[model samples]
Target: MGRSLVRHPGVRGCYTAGNKRFLQLNELDELRMDVYENVKLYKEWTKQWHDSKITRKEIIVGDKVLLFNSRFQLFPRNLRSRWSGPFEVVTVFPYGSFELKNNKGECLKVNGHRVKYFYEGQPIQARGELELEDLPSLWDE
Candidate 1:
């Protein structure tokens, strides 16, 4: 005792794997199977999952981080390229954004997503000949 299939132009029967069957409970079974599959797939997708990530959340202002430089523009015909380098975190704004200073010591403000962070940050030194003592020694400083 199940409901009938949705009427087709020229049929009063049901379709299984391929062929037509006359008045079986096929439609009801198919509906039940589809509902069960959908529920199963949703549960599997929403189950708990683990991912490797840095657990620390104490990045404060004045910390140094490395930014990423990529040529691809998010907007069409964007004039300036997204530039990145060792920048000092100058000020943390209200939201998840911070003011940054570039390698030349110029102040520029940017959002969090636009700049990436480095765990072991390095100080920016001038190009050409940078001697060992000229750069801030990581261990010593």
Candidate 2:
């Protein structure tokens, strides 16, 4: 009689509950897989965007460049500049490396990423000079 009651159509069976639990577990697994794929795609997009923003430095042998000063100094001043050199590029190596010559004739090999091209000054524009006699004086009025 008990077996018959358990197997009755109106009564909730153990096998039915087990089947529902198994289905729920499968749904959770599918959702987890989807999240993993989305995270991977996001990482790939971030890497691509970062790579696009990077500018390639074209360094030549004779160009003047400033080297980054990365050395740790004690009691560093707040207004001090971090770049140390207006060094001349003596040689450019194959893979983003450079040989630099300082003003004291000291040669140092450093990575190209640490150096930037230095601009001395802008070209001076020529204009006609005006004398004080040709200028209008506000005091005369």
Candidate 3:
């Protein structure tokens, strides 16, 4: 003897219209539940995928970094430079806050996200001997 298929709860019969078959109300509900579960799984995967691509910047005190000038971005200009300073890092606080010192001896506290490591074409060299002429004075000439 052949086994009979059981109807879903509250579903009396299959729905059909114009050569297309439709799911019963309970079956449709099950499909919706499956879709919801899939959406949640995809959301988690997307978060992991996004985080995997992010490169965390390692910052420390005394490091030289360039601050991104967001103000310039507001007024879009062809020739305007958006980055300013190879500022010295004076302090580092929790959660990406950093204190920087500029050439004018002005100190500013800013978020780490706005700063990036300063890069020059060549590496800086430090010599043990101090040459007075080579050193820049604190006071402007």
Which structure among the candidates has the greatest lDDT?
2
User: Where does model 1 exceed 4 Å of error?
Assistant: 1-57, 73-83, 119-141
Q: Which ranking of candidates, highest TM-score first?
A: 2, 3, 1
Query: Candidate 3 on 1-141: residue-level lDDT in tens?
Result: 253454556767633342123335557889999999999999999999999999998989998999998873555987967789989999999999999999998999999899999866777788699889898988977
Q: 36 in model 3: Cα distance from truth in Å?
A: 1.1
Query: How well does model 2 score by local distance difference test?
Result: 0.88
As for TM-score, the candidate ahead, 1 or 3, is: 3
Q: What local distance difference test score does each model get? A: 0.68, 0.88, 0.84
Model 2 Cα displacement at 45 (Å)? 1.5
Candidate 2: tens digits of C-alpha lDDT, residues 14-55: 445556676688799999999999999999999999999999
Prediction 1 global C-alpha lDDT? 0.68
Q: Which stretches of candidate 3 lie over 4 Å from their true place?
A: 1-23, 72-74, 123-141
User: What's the C-alpha lDDT at position 47 in model 1?
Assistant: 63
Q: Quick one: how many clashes does candidate 2 have? A: 0
TM-score: which candidate is best?
A: 2
Q: What TM value does model 2 have?
A: 0.71
